[model samples]
Target: MRSRRGALSEVYDLLRSEIIAGVFDPGAQLVELVLAEKYGTSRTPIREALRRLEQDGLVERGERGLRVRTRSPEEILEIYEVRIYLEAMAASTAAQRRSDFDLIRIRRAQETMDDTSTDDPAAMAAANRAVHETIWAASHNGTVVDLLTRLNNHLTRYPATTLKTPGRWPEALQEHWAMIDAIEQRDSARAHDLARDHMTKARELRLELYRADPSA
Candidate 1:
């Protein structure tokens, strides 16, 4: 006994997941008539679902109506590489400059993240941001923190955080644990290396995803 609202919600989730996974491909038009047929619904629900996607930044309306937004893989890579260097420096500085209280805050952030389900992207993204921001604070560099925050916002143009990718959560969690240990031990080099490796691995996985779906 699914209500119309329930069906519309389901359709929205289905379309959102597909779009993020690149199933719809960038710039692919989402025609109301085609979607209505595909989801076995009226144009009303289809429109509702599309409006949600548009609001989410997963779609855009032009002269041709709604199309999946084009994601520039090159820009994604460039942004990531920049983050890698900044994160490596931040982690190293954090290891050198952090107090016990700073470390405790970072530990708390990761614990919160671990307690949340990976299926919830918003929660994971929020936790992830908190954890990183804490580390940046520990670095005691306002300039770097401000720059990284801006860079992170640009990343939303891509799919959500890589934390929710299949099999990535556990690996990422372990990496975070190791990073915490390195920073706690005041091993600046180790912390820097771990941070770089973590970002590098994520970059590789994300590039593969972009390569597989060459619609844009």
Candidate 2:
């Protein structure tokens, strides 16, 4: 009962979600025929979906056609560095210009993410993304929001299992609270410092986990 356009859109969303949740592992080839069968759609929609993912940096074309991009330790570090600067800028701007409504929305996101104490990588990743998106939305900067969206897409390639570690969830929740408090108080400097520190800590944690992993 769906139009061709709607079918294509659904295929795209399905593929995007699978890639983001690590269902498609790094370097795994995306065979159009396989995906088309899996999604119960035609190859045309599958190709369109892959093309969209390529534009989002989630997939790349190789001699084998499309494959999920891999994340190296160095690349993860670079991403964190960029995120630190951009997130800090967003937090600082949000602190300076946030209205009561914005603060309330941020606080709600913080509350929603507060109870994210689970070993489920997918759930934690979703909650973490919600927190960041809420904070970025408070900034009211279109360009920064667009940049963060791209950065987040790249970051989804990283092994999010790091956040599922025993104590990391609590630490991350506390950091989110600190950021919320800074924004609520209109403390631009504090918000910027906190945002940078939060991302730096996450980078350190991920690096340590990567070092400990034999497969990394």
lDDT leader: 2
Q: Write the per-residue lDDT of candidate 2 for residues 51-114, one digit (tens) a residue.
A: 8899888999888788998767897788888998999999999999888999988888778777
Q: lDDT tens string, model 1, 125-162? A: 77878888999999999988977876674465566567
Against the correct fold, how does model 1 do in TM-score?
0.66
Worst 10-residue lDDT window for candidate 2 reads 157-166
RMSD of 2: 2.2
**Which has the greatest TM-score?**
2
Candidates in order have lDDT scores of 0.84, 0.85
lDDT of 1: 0.84
Off by over 4 Å in 1: 1-70, 213-216
Badly placed stretches (over 4 Å) of model 2 are 119-121, 214-216
